[model samples]
Target: MNEHDFLLMFSCLPTSNKNEWLNLKTFVDIYNSKHDTNYILKSFPENDNRTSPEPEILLCDGDAKMVIERKVFAFPPSYIRDHQLWHEFHNTFLRQVADIFSDNLYELQIKDVDIPTNKKEIIALAKEIASTVIEYKQEIKNSEGIYSDDLIPWSFFQLSDLEREDSPIDCGVCVRLKISSHFYNNQQLNDSLPMIEAQLIKLLKASAPKFDNYSDCLRILILEPHTKVLNLSINFLSQVIQSIEIPSSIDQVWLATQFERDDEELIRDYYLVVSNL
Candidate 1:
């Protein structure tokens, strides 16, 4: 089932004492029953023991194999931070299982935490995380495909093609545009450039004479994707492009359009073309 269905199913399940151990046990029981699979759930060993416990849940097809860990909690900002106990437990478990599972093992962190208020928000987050995990797993499965290929060399798009020698722009703008082009071509959807533009405009409008360096502007932009800003007029994108002194070349314009289209393979092909040029 999809993430939303999973969440809804989880919500329908009976609530327990809300204790971590108890909640985990309930999940294990429900999951096994629902899937009609033999999944054995075991508690982690105490700190005094030299051997780390096997993962929380083991799914067996023939022998016990797949491992999953459950972390249930109210939403806390520091839940995944390095210093947090949950984070420590997660890292430790991965390290312990590194050799035991060898190649066939999979790790899943199922969290029943408070999600954002938006509709299907939890599902959206879950899907994004799951997609990332699937991508990583696929990469690992195709080890030959990875090691057989040489790394592509980093190359820059030609600014000379812009045909405007006396363009009034900061050197940082050129650098960022080149980097953006590189990422866009490689099918990397980095939401930082537009974000930075918004922040830069805010700061510029606030303090007329004060100038911020490129890195400072970029740092603000890279904070998060501007979902709110996306709903604004097309003029917003134009303003950002103009502020960055981006090239007016037809190729550059077409590349930007490809980014808007969000076709992954096409973007990658564009990147190849730009790199070759």
Candidate 2:
């Protein structure tokens, strides 16, 4: 991530209960609007020594009560570590490349290179990338689109015309990830489905015990996947839920998803799955 973007994302980090209440309120509002039910936020119960396990959010509909247990489906530790390392590598590469190419926009497609976490190795790789771009800039200056051979490990595709204009900072670089046959295989989605199912089962089993105290009230299990790439819907989850044994205490299961518009605006929605509402 760029410095501007890194600052923008982290600076607005969600505090304890304020942001969380807003999120839960949004979900409750959507539920009320769609299902024609009037449920209002009562209180966010505290989890203390007296209450060993408390629901995150409580809703009251006059005489009736609702309990929501929010859970985030997180990525595996190994994947998260790799993702962070890659971001560091990209940032380091940009710092080196910006000094070298200052006037034009270049899209560098790096391939077949194992990204190293060591600072010295990362610096060496970044320098090598900058030098490679400088060496081939003149040879492919006139060409557009992909200009490298199939056997070549990397390809350089200049996105914008080499328009040299006076600017304050260096040029913009958009680095594309390496593409391989393994990424295009049909088995990738198939492999991921099982992982998703396993995660769902684990989350359900872990959260079920929290609802034991709320037997008098309607119990809800809200699962929000930490990613937006997967196309999760009621139908897909319905099929997966058939195999797992849902706890008797859970009255309903809902999947919360976030959608991003072309203008970068975000909209969060909730879909009911395994419902007994």
Candidate 3:
């Protein structure tokens, strides 16, 4: 909690500008004085690819760290935690996407242990997914309906998973998907391009200040965003990285989500980091 102690711990921020660094340091120093223990508050911008909730503040000391991301959602109507609702939403969107892409396999081999595995194959698959994402994004943008969450879910195949599956027919490797609301039925897509631009603008403004210090990283973990919006969010962050007033302050920008695996217990929830950036 001592100013001298904190100065010794973090030796870089002050190098940028005395006034600015002092402001940030003094803020934490005051926080430390309030509590009995000395503390190093990392707004946790998630150092070293660490995965957890976006912490408001983290108390880090040696190997012992306490995360303060606690919240009490007193019976909120809009806070969606019900897995069934999400599953239903995702399933509906998947079915719609399936109907659209049924005839447009684009040469992707549906046979077991098949499809592209090389870099070219990977690029081909990415392009296919990108195209689909754009279509769904457009559909959502053009809809006249309201949304608490307007993003649509997208499903696709992973070459590695598809190839490793012994029973490709029911392996479920080809259908990585999410769910969304039922507001996108036969919606006319008006001003799709404008919508994309506006969304990108929103993302950049929201993400810019997340990294305050030059060493801080910007890593956002989304709960249930539209599949297309996820792609767009990453792309938008990348596009604005260089344009920001002090871009170097942000070392990296990551968009990650929770995933399941064989060793899920060890990590509680593993995050799969992804970014168009």
Candidate 4:
């Protein structure tokens, strides 16, 4: 398999750095803690080319008894598409200027919504960014260590030196660009209800059949969010799941994501969607 495909599919394997691995691990940890069981990773049946409709992950207490089918859902699809295009631009830009910005930690915050889609435009924009970085490298390296510049196709761009004392983590890199959108609320989440329910039902339909072979096992469907904004509420999610039809073979469906507690600490948390118990 190719590197991308392997990384995407085998994320449930032990010690994998992929977010899916984190989702699965978090679910397992929560499950073990809640149930007081010693279930551990058993195997990845989906990787077996010989099998049909295989489970993404299988967990065991003593013998194989639980099956996990994972699906990543994104809302308003455009966000993920734009985010990907940004990464494409990032790669081209980094390749063009990696030598110039060597060994300095930086974060490029962009407020560009109209991101380029085509390869030609992406490459051209990357060049533009490379030039911009070059033009401000001296000022960027100054003691203050922050620069804001405007460019075509982007209204605002800010570069910050992450090596400062207030930096979140010490990324020992020349520069790093982080893309994120933290604008979302319960009202917006409610507005996307129909689309969310439709997409989730489609996923259940696809994954449910895979559990036919594992009827004796505790079947679980994990829906992980791929979009930047999926501020899911337990009450809202419970209502959505109640309106849908989960397959009989699947005993549970869980929405797993990073949860911020009342204490402002972020932890992996799961909310039950469909529970036969």
Candidate 5:
């Protein structure tokens, strides 16, 4: 989702108890309002289901040149008040990962950048991705209690031409394997800030393949539980990119945050953060 439009939605509710937020129709209207009520989307229920369908929460234009998906996750006061939220909220994230890894080439392709040149390798990649999902599930389960004080505990799922087998594509990907806090509490978030600042240096050592043989490509890292990172998300991504062996190949990465608007209830925000760094 676009920042301006999403901010409009977030501004509407501000901060509520989670059960008292605007509906999706209101959100769509608010988002479309900035477009001068362009014919793109008039309203929901009518134009809502009819246009802009991307995988899950993603949105794509007519040409599918750009695909944008969001993870709408916010905690209602009631939901957070009950406690026992750790895995419950994280499992929802795992669900998103499962959905993404299951994507066919068409589902993950990035226009203008990704090419369909290598079908065989693409299939092999998909099969490995599927197995990786199974492996991570067990890993997530096995590593359940352990929390990282410095690292985000992310995973590496894919680094390819948006799942295309083409040899001449420009899409690569990486994964982060932790929830918002990385198993730390409020204090932990505070403590990790400094360490998180050094993420780029860490990623240089992090194991990942070079997508482009001659160089690298457009690398997109979809991170969840971005609610905690906020302004720091871009910095985190920038550092990671800079530390890469060849930073030029990576076009950009997106940080996904699911949050209860500062003021509204029931209306959560699915924010996809894209930065030039």
Candidate 6:
């Protein structure tokens, strides 16, 4: 489906209050009303004593089978200081959900909500949240294995400072951009975008592909504040592409471009701008 169509099927959950939940529900409902697919909410059973349900949102497919969870927040400082708490709450909730549903239940998905802030602390907070969600989801996979259809896949999304326009560049954003760049590209030089994309695809094949071509999958979206950092990441990606040798079947690289609009532009530029060895 198209981006709008995909978004409609994807759910948003904010673990804050009724207003936020209603806001997200309203958005999904509006979007789905235009599309043919179905969207529904799956509330945590009230009797089930969990972490107060955290007030998150879920988006399901036509069959009410596929699901996506959305988590929204304000800034990085809040997330950074309470990173551990977020993880505990999220993990506890997921495990409890798994327990409630058992192995026979349908798949569930998790996604972090996007916040518009450019503070370094806020950007860092978003990255931390993204990393935590990835880690937590990985742990679940390790414990449950891919065969267990009951497992819920998780992803993250955060709005970048670029979206805010009025925000300043934070040291945290620079650090995270640099680190993520190095982590993905440093190991594989000489790797084509298609190849690197392929490997990432393989990594998430059973669960959620880092980038979902289809809207059914929940994704982590990050918005970048500065083009310079985006350029740096592309350079880093170029290095990664050059360093590694990969097969041909891979078509695209799947990265969380939630906040890096400039990077998205550069990805398009890669077609014309050949790497200068």
Top candidate on lDDT is: 4
Candidate 3, residues 1-277: lDDT per residue as tens digits?
A: 2211111111011122223323234434543566454657654434433553233445565554433221111111122233223334334444445444443221122221232334444345445544554455444334421222212223343234345544334322134322233222213222233453355445445444443432222222221122322222333333333343323322333222222356532211111223332
lDDT tens readout by residue for model 2, 206-270: 88887888887889888765432233333454467666778887889877655556766666667
| Residues 234-258 of candidate 5: C-alpha lDDT, one tens digit per residue | 3344344344453443334334323
CA lDDT scores, all candidates in order: 0.29, 0.62, 0.33, 0.64, 0.32, 0.33
Clashes of 1: 1
Give TM per candidate: 0.20, 0.60, 0.24, 0.73, 0.25, 0.23
User: What's the C-alpha lDDT at position 205 in model 3?
Assistant: 52
Deviation of model 4 at 171, angstroms = 8.5
- Candidate No. with top TM-score: 4
| CA RMSD per model (angstroms) | 28.3, 8.6, 19.9, 7.7, 20.6, 21.0
Q: Is candidate 4 or candidate 6 better by TM-score?
A: 4
* lDDT, candidate 1, 208-267, per-residue tens: 211121111111110011122222222333344345532211112111111223332221
State the weakest 10-residue window (summed lDDT) of model 5.
Answer: 106-115
lDDT of 1 at 110: 36
Candidates 1 and 6, the one with greater lDDT: 6
Off by over 4 Å in 2: 1-18, 22-25, 38-42, 46-51, 61-63, 74-82, 95-104, 111-158, 161-171, 178-196, 226-234, 258-267
